[model samples]
Target: MDSVRTCVACRKRASRTELLRVVVHEGRLVADDRAVLPGRGAWVHPTARCLDRAVSRGSFPRALRVSGKPDAGPIENRLKTLMDN
Candidate 1:
């Protein structure tokens, strides 16, 4: 059977492959494209809406089990690049 995960923002379960993995590194949030990052991670749909929801709801730090707000600039820039291409 395929693995499943819940989106931190939407709180919906989905096939693991259908979601993007995010992790906190150096107190910043980054997309884990390979899903092999070494840390507590959060999964989310790879869309701006989901990303925005996660951010606006302040879910990143909680999902990632970290204190304070983690920088999501990297993820935003990556998403922008993907949209542009």
Candidate 2:
């Protein structure tokens, strides 16, 4: 069976393949498309709406169990690229 995960922004439960995995790396938020990154991960829908909501609500730090906010620029850029394709 497919694993399940909750989207940090929307707070909706969905299959792991249906969400994008995000992890903190080098003080920045990185999207793990292959879901193979080390460390704790927070899942979110790969869309601008979810990304914006998560960032605006400061969900990453809490969900990832991090202290401060990690730079979200990298993930934002990644979402943009994904949307363009």
Q: All models: lDDT?
A: 0.90, 0.97
In every candidate, how many clashes are there? 0, 0
For candidate 2, the lDDT comes to: 0.97
- lDDT per residue, candidate 2, 1-85, as tens digits? 9999999999999999999999999999999989999999999999999999999999999999999889999999999999999
Clashing residue pairs in candidate 2 are none
Of candidate 1, the 10-residue stretch with the lowest lDDT total is: 76-85
Runs in model 1 deviating more than 4 A are none
